[model samples]
Every structure is written in structure tokens, then in C-alpha cells.
Target: MNWDDMRVFLATARAESLTAARGTLRLDPATIARRITRLEEAAGAALFLKSPQGYRLTEAGLRLLAHAEEAETALSRGIGALSGSAEQLGGTIRIGAPDGCATYLLPQVCARIAEAHPDLDLQILALPRIVNLSRREADLAITVSRPKTDRLHGERLSDYKLSLAASRAFLAAHGVPKSVSDLKDMRMIGYIPDMIFDAELDYLSALGVTRVPLASTSVSVQLQMARAGGGLAVVHDFALPTAPELTRVLPGDVALTRTFWLTTHAGPKDARLDRITGLLRDGIRDEIARLEAMPVARNP
Candidate 1:
């Protein structure tokens, strides 16, 4: 019957892992487990089934989840209304996004947000895998593909270009590819085939590459490898600017396009969410424009 217990229950259910719930609540695993136990005892029913994978909601837990979420929404709206003043608005907003976008772009976005709202905190989880918004893993997520669930809302944030690139040193050591066919002889850096989290990141296939000689699960790693003259990589145009020494390979002959989709759970409307979303949209547009204007090096 304790609201605090219910809050813990909701967080645990959404995260499905004591470790993840602990991160969200900033509580120890032992304490979270104890709260769930207390909550179950009060309700006179088991709320969760524990397994190695994580905690899964029991039927009782599932039934109670809806009521708890409704209460949470009401409370959030009340808090927002009470803190209507811009200066008073403050809370942590967790954003989950692909590693490349989060690493290269979101730092600037978060900086601008912090400037506008000094008290608000932004947490960026630059994960390679998909973030589960339905589970509240992230307050907002920037996904390569849109979610098909009705419980979440999303919009196309921006369409960015991808192209083949290599370090100036790599090109100097291994000859530049004059055409797409020449790419077959070059050492290619890319995502590990089985480890690619999203299908849209399968950049090599689109470029007529069926096998990758050098690959990694992390985009950041791939970029580093390319910069170290390991091989050529298909990298985002926006991200390429970070390494000015890297030159585009087969610039005119090869180009791939992908979209970034922004998603959030359908919950209580918060003014802070609106402001952050606007910032994200504007930031991405500016970056895309900058990327479009970047000149690519053509092979002689």
C-alpha cells in the first residue's frame, strides 16, 4: 500500500533487471529486492518471477502495473504544474541513442540544453543495441528504425548520409580505389556481421561488400581502426568531420542514406520533454546541413 513501494515495483518491472532498476533508482540491489518482497507481502500475492535472465512480471504484477503507471502519470503532471516556472523546472532526462550519434552529436545537444536549463540533468546512454522505451530503459530514444508499438510515439528526426572513408595514411599505403570494383581488393573495416544491432547498419552490403576483413561491434572502434590505417570504413558524413585527416573513398560512386527516429513513451506530458525534443530536432538539422556541405575527396 506504500506509494514508495509501488514506485520501486514499477521501476523493477520496467527494467526487468535488478541492476538496471538500481541504476534508475540509485539504490542498492539488496534494497530493491527487499522493497519488491515487501510490496508482494502487502498485496498478498507474488509480483515477480526471478530468473537468470532477469525478473519477469507475474500475472499479479502485470495487473498492478497499469494502476501504478496511472498514479505515476498523475504525480508527474502535478509536479510539472507545481513547478511551472522555467527557473524551477528540474529533473533528469535519460536519452538512449546509437553510439555514433550519441558520441559525436549529443554532447553538443546536451550542452545547449544545459545552457538553457542549468538545473536539469541529461543522461545519455550511447548504447549499440536498441533501447526499450516500453520498459522505461530510457526516457527518450533515438533509433535507426521506428518502433511499431502503439505504446510509444516517434518521428523522423533527420536523414543523414553515409559514405566510404579511409585515413590519408591508409590510402597512401594501400592505393585509392578508383571504382567500386577496386574496393574488393582493399581491406574493409565494418561492423561484425552477427553483432550488428540494427539492420540499417549493415553498410558493407549496400556497397557491394559481402565480407569484412576487419570488423568490430563498436562504431567508435571501427572509426579508430580506419584512422589508424587499418582499412576503409563506411562512416557517417557528420561523424567524419571529427577526423579531418580521413578522406572519403569513392565519394561520388558510393553513397548510403539512413534516418534517425526519435521516440518516447506515451506518458504524462512534461514541458521539459518538449523543450529537449525541440533542441534535438534543431541540433540534428544543423549537423545534417554541415555534413551536406562537407567536401569529399575524389580518387585521382
Candidate 2:
């Protein structure tokens, strides 16, 4: 089979549906079907078994997947090698991250990278839930926990702090809690407990916070509600500078630590991605240090 047919087959195999694969391949479902049929004819095997759910790979398909992925990796390396100088390298790179990092951290980090590589295009997916790298939804993803699967490679990006916080206006009207016990009777803002995607984010539960009167799955939403004097919320320490209206409450009593992990699909190295990752790693760490160093409102 030709490389074109193999490319379509690879995307279809990963997505498991002609319609789903259409999004990434930018081809119509009919075109994808035709290409898959041509590929199967050339190989003289039924690569996929059709079912109600989607396309299920047969044993032969599974075997071909390994070679196909290796070919893709080789193509990536070839492109990286011929991509000329790092200064002139230009292509789109998509990043998936939790809203806190997406909203508060990535803009400046990406802006600097874009400034350096004027031809490069960057897109950030600010998702409340975990980003699915296996789906090829993002070229790179930032996560709270280290990935467990061997199909993905993960690296610790940085460690940042979190703390209970409230707006100055909220404390003025509702008063501050003197003890963690007192928080039981107060209004709180945080993630919807049932919707929390990661255990590392369950900061309020440890504070004996059983109820969140104002809750959301998105960190940016919780920060806005807290800024509007909604209630106490567990907020990123590095994010405090961005929300000066909100003040840290019982910083000593509620300090938390969590690490950000950079993740990518496991494959042969691509120099372009390697360089971009280095810039991102260094940029994020420096930005956090700078933001956390800025003066933030805190209670005595």
C-alpha cells in the first residue's frame, strides 16, 4: 500500500471511526473509507471488524499498528531533520492543560515562545478533565499526575503550591474563620467533588470542607467566583498575582504542594518537539517563580 493509504489507515485505526478520523485527517468519511478499503485490498486482509460501537481492529490490524506507528515516527524525524534551522522552524503545536495552568500560566509562556519563533503557531486546550494524548487531541499535554502507561512518556515539569483563599470583600462581609472547624459552617468555592478528575486536586476535602456552596469543575470559574466574594476556594499560589482581589486565607494552615507533568506520545525523538519542550519546561518554571514572588494579599 502507498504511504497515503497507510496514513489514512493509521488515523482511522487510532480514532476507530471514519467520522472521528475525519476531524484530524480533514477528509470526508467516504474518502477515508475508500482509502481504508484500498489498504485492506493491498494487504489482502480484513484489518478492521465493523460493529455497532465502531471499527474494532483484528489481530492483523493490531500487528500492522506497530509498524505503522514506527513509520510515523520515522517520518517525524525526517521532517525534523529537514526543518532547516531551529530559528526558521514553523508549525502548529497544540497543548492540553488544566484550566489553572491554561489560563494563568500558558498565555505568557506561549507568548514568549511565539515571540521567539514568529512562524510557529500554538494552541492550548484548557480542559477541566484529563487530556487524552492517545487520541492525538494534543501534541503535548500538561498533567497533575505522572502517566502510568508505557505508550506515553511523562516528565515532571514543576512543583507549585496551593492554599485556601477568599476575596477581601468576602472577608469584610462574612468574616474570616479562626480555625478549620469554623469552615464547616461557612460558604466555600471549589471543584465539584464528583467531577474532580485527579486526587491531587482534592484539596478542600482534606481541609474537612464537606460542602462547596459555589462549585465548578473549572479552576478559572472557581477563581472568578472567589474574586467576586463568593466564598473560600483552594487556589494556586502562583495564580494569586493574577487575582489580586483575592487574599490567601490561613496560608500556613492550608498550604498544599502539587507537581505538573509534561506528557507526550511515546515514539522516536523529534528534534522540533524536543526543542519546544525545553522552552516550555524552562518558561513555565520561570513564570511560576516570578508570579509567586509577586506580592499577594494574605491574612495575618
Best by lDDT: 2
* Predicted structure 1: clash tally: 0
Question: What value does the lDDT take at residue 32 in candidate 2?
Answer: 88
CA-RMSD of model 2: 1.5
**Any idea what lDDT model 1 has?**
0.84
Error of 1 at 195 (Å): 0.8
Give the C-alpha miss distance for residue 105 in model 1, angstroms. Answer: 1.3
- lDDT per residue as tens, model 2, 109-200: 99999998898899999998999887778889999999999999999999998888999889989998898888988899999999999998
Poorly placed runs, candidate 2 (over 4 Å)? none
TM-scores of the models, in the order given: 0.90, 0.95
Where does model 1 exceed 4 Å of error? 17-20, 26-30, 51-53, 87-89
Minimum summed lDDT over a 10-residue window in model 1 is located at: 80-89
- Evaluated at residue 22, the lDDT of candidate 1 is 93
**Best candidate, TM-score:** 2
